[model samples]
Target: MNKNISAGWRDFHASAKVYYLWLALGWVEIRQRYSRSKIGPFWLTISMGILIAALGVVYGTLFKADLKSYLPLLAVGFVFWAFISTTISEGCNAFIAGSAYIRQMPLSRGIFVFQTIWRNIVILGHNFIIVIAVLAIFKINFLPGLAWFVLGFLLLVVNLFWMSALLAVVCARFRDLPQIITSALQVVFYITPILFKRDMLSKYPLLIDLNPFAHMIEIVRGPLLGEPVPAVSWLACTAMAVVGILICLAFHGRYRSRIPYWV
Candidate 1:
């Protein structure tokens, strides 16, 4: 019998606990999200729908773009932005929020970091339905090819996990790190093709070349655009994942013990 599990080279049953923990964390996030809203999770769907309508009108007309084209981009970009921006901001307090658990339990620090990202993914999953609805409302043809889109999504999650681990450790150690991340993300939004197009990049080629968020957005958005991403981009992200994972591992090894204390 094969007993080696793939991810950590451990037993399958042992790693199964992590998946269950993800489920539990996701459940908690869902509950907390709706605790204040009367409509609960439906608030996400309704709010997004309204924003899409308003922004689609204003930005589309401002840019002289058609609704069919602009709305789809807006939907996908916002959905992806929710994941990225949420990961960055939430990661700053990931350990701090769970100070009691970190101090009390001999738990896998990696799992809690992963939990922060996974919980957001679950929320984003709920929000993707809104994207689909926006597509239908705007009459944009969305590709239903599960394999390609799912692969892109999985890669995005992988990147998030690595990022969350690294950011959580940093923020736990440096309280001001969260504010710096917020500032960086604000600068990134203006440059990203969110309310604009790749034309913005063409206008300033140097900006696009230097903007990591552009590459990050394309890694997921390219597939949704029916353009399977170029191998160069894919390879670059893979290399990034490797480097990020290594950094997180080093952080985990060195400071996982100190996280609760720092928090």
Candidate 2:
């Protein structure tokens, strides 16, 4: 067990040594995705802008919230949520999706995970432009909390690394898991306080308080929306990152070598 754990940690670190290779690969993926398209990746920004505008108006009116305030929140929330949700849900297929590379060459499995996160980071950059526009239109002062937003984003990336590691291994072994993860994420989306404020469920704070996704979203969305940093979210996410890393270390140590076979 100890040797396996050590090996897993070593493999994870070794993969980071080739960060540039995978990062470039990630960009290649984005470029290929829009190879012939004129607007390229900005289509993500345009689509997100449309969603935010349409949903913000409809949900704001339905919930009796002000558009000036709610639109910025929705825009930031959706951008972050899209990144988070896509990273996690797609992470299940990380190893399986890279089956060709895993079998044809001797490469670090961690590269695939990093590629997934990096690809989403690129997409997030595109989507975040919409959030900036919404904030500007609403006159929200996001510059004041820029430091916290960066910190939160870094922490979120840490969380995603561990998450992708674990899911990559598990989903490779269990073929049906990708579908299950998709369904579960869909359920989590409705429960998370993205479209609706947590205050609406004031009577049952646990709904949001106990949800890691809510905290994940809050840490990033809070600062962008000019809201105070939720200390509870910071602490919760930090703890989860630590725990997730430990779990990934153990899981990968025991199963990392078998990933290619499974795929």
Candidate 3:
């Protein structure tokens, strides 16, 4: 892990123009995502608004929950779920998607993984507006200490970065991984507390303790709900991130050059 970071640091510093290159690629990603749409980025806003409305009207009633009471939790949970879902799903193709560049250019392989994460963050930015709008309309009294939520978001991004690095290398060589990962993510969606309140786990406290996704989502939403942070879970996830980075770095260092051939 240390070796990979050292190498990455050297590579990053050696190139004076890497920022310009990454910025250009990031901008291109933004354009490519919205190129065919008429209204471009607003499509994200519209899609999320409709989905939330549909679920709020449909599932909220089916679950016998009040729209005003549950909509805020649902919206926030769904938005963060989108972040985790897309980052991993896209990470599986991060290397494959940039095959042309990997083969033809002398760019760092890490850049592609970073680009995937960056693009997902941009998409999250668009979807976040819908969450904020929903929270406002329903008059949900979210936490006033905004800094904690920001801290949680930064950690979430850090976690996604680690996941992307590992998956990008693994799926580069094993291309079918994307489909399998997407399927697993679908199952995770149901088990995650996206459509229900956290208190629903009162009788099933074991479920709360076992769910990694639950902890991940809670780190971000707990602050928003005026709840206290979970220090133990946060530390545990940080350890996982460290171990994940080691594994990913070992794999990436071994196969970084082979990526072009695989792609």
Candidate 4:
């Protein structure tokens, strides 16, 4: 077991040195996606802007919440969710999708996972414009603890890396897992406090307390909204990150050799 764990760390260390390769590949993938398009990734910003506008009005009226409060929250939530959901869903196929490269090149599987993260992060950058605009419109001043947003976001990325690594291996081995993950995320979206306010769940506050995604969202979104950083959120998210890292390291070490055959 120790040998396997050591081998996995060695593979990851080797892969870390080739950051430029995966970073370039991730950018190239985005460029190729919009190679012939006039607007390029801006199309994502436009569509998301429209979706948030429509949902904000509809749900705002439905729930009788102030647009001033709800729109900004919804906009930020949508952008972060896009980053989180895509990272997880697409991550399941990160290794399998890169089978051609995996089979031909001597690369660490970690590169493919980073590629997936980079691609979504680029898209998230585009959506972030809308978040800033919404905050400005609402007169939400930037707070001193805004630095916590950076901390929370980096922690989230840590969790995402482990998740991508684990899922890439698991889904490569089990063909049906990608489909199951998709369905599970769909369910999670509704349960998460993105579309609704936490106040509504006053009777069952545990719903939000128990949700890792809610904690993840709040830690980032709270600072953006100039709200107090929830101590529980930071604690829960960090604990989850540690657990995810252990799981990913163990799995990668044990199955690193088998990935090529599975893919």
lDDT of 4 by residue, 1-263 (tens): 67777877888777788999889989999999999999899998999999999999999999999999999889888889988999999999999989999888888878898889988888999889998899888889866657889998999898888888999999999999999999999999998888998778889988899988998898889889888867999999999999888778878999988888999
lDDT of each: 0.72, 0.89, 0.78, 0.89
| Candidate 3 structure quality by residue, lDDT tens digits, 1-263 | 67766665444344334666656687798898789878887787788889988988888989899888678778888889988998999888888988888889888877777777777888888888987787779766666847878877877877787788778878877877888989999997887788877677688876766777787898888777666767866875677667766666666766676888888
Lowest-sum lDDT 10-residue window in model 1: 1-10
Backbone clash count for every predicted candidate, in the order shown:
0, 0, 0, 0
* Candidate 2 local lDDT, 1-263, one digit each (tens): 67777888888788899999889989998999999999999988887788788999899999999888888878888889999989988788999888999998999788899999999999998888898888888788889899999999999999988998899899999999889988999999998999998788899899999999999999999998889867899999999998888888888988988987999
- Of candidate 4, the 10-residue stretch with the lowest lDDT total is 1-10
Q: Is candidate 3 or candidate 4 better by TM-score?
A: 4
How does candidate 3 score on lDDT? 0.78
Which model is ahead, 3 or 4, in terms of lDDT? 4
lDDT of 1: 0.72
Check candidate 4 and list the clashing pairs.
none
Cα TM-score per model: 0.87, 0.97, 0.89, 0.97
Residue 18, model 4: Cα distance from true site in angstroms: 0.4
